[model samples]
Target: MALGKVKELVSSNPVVIFSNKFCPYCVCVKQLFVLKLGVQYKAIELDQESDGSEIQSALAEWTGQHTLPNVFVGGYHIGDCDSKFDLTP
Candidate 1:
């Protein structure tokens, strides 16, 4: 189910942010995309979902990295928050 949700998010949104509401890094990542880059994005708050852990597990399996703010842009895996900074000036 989590995998399905992940796929749906990736396929539907140009920018998908799988985040935890309480996470600082997650908040930062969202700001980078929405505020700095001016790209409209979809953010799924994993911490609010009952199957958030399951989704995180599936993301780890899919991306081979278990970190919050798992970001995907244009259906491409864009790594974590640190990687996002690397894309910026």
Candidate 2:
């Protein structure tokens, strides 16, 4: 299932971002990782993918929350843009 894939991504990568490219909040999260933290992350832009909605839905089911820029770090669901910013070093 798509949710399984979402979990796999979260577990496998140090940082994972499930986002929508057009969303400013999503953009902010990406910038935080790439610009501020200078870390490479796996950014899955749902808006750009054909099965994005399904993936987003699956992410919600798995993580118990739904929003743009769902962020996972070190296999932990760290939450959205603001949460990601909080984790920035």
Candidate 3:
């Protein structure tokens, strides 16, 4: 179910960020996309969700990444904070 939800979100949004509100890395990623690049994105605050744990677990299974700021772009998993920065100039 959680995997299905993740898939639905990834497919529907051009950019999706699975994040935690308090994580600094998550904040950085959000700022880089929304502020630095001025790109619109859907941010799913996992810590604020009722099934946050389940969603995180599903994200790990799907992406092989067990970290905050899991990012997706145009239906492709873009990895974590460091990975996102690596793609940027």
Note the Cα lDDT for every prediction shown: 0.88, 0.87, 0.93
Which residue pairs overlap in candidate 1's backbone? none
Worst 10 residues of 2 by lDDT: 80-89
By lDDT, the candidates rank as 3, 1, 2
lDDT of 3 by residue, 1-89 (tens): 99999999999999999999999999999999988999999999999999999999999999999998999988888899666334442
Using TM-score, rank the candidates from best to worst: 3, 1, 2
RMSD, every candidate, angstroms: 2.9, 2.8, 2.7
- For 1-89, candidate 1 gives per-residue lDDT tens digits of 78888998899999999999989999998898778999989988998989989999999999997988899888888888666444432
Stretches of model 2 off by over 4 angstroms after superposition:
82-89
Candidate whose TM-score is highest: 3
Compared with the true structure, the alpha-carbon lDDT of candidate 2 equals 0.87
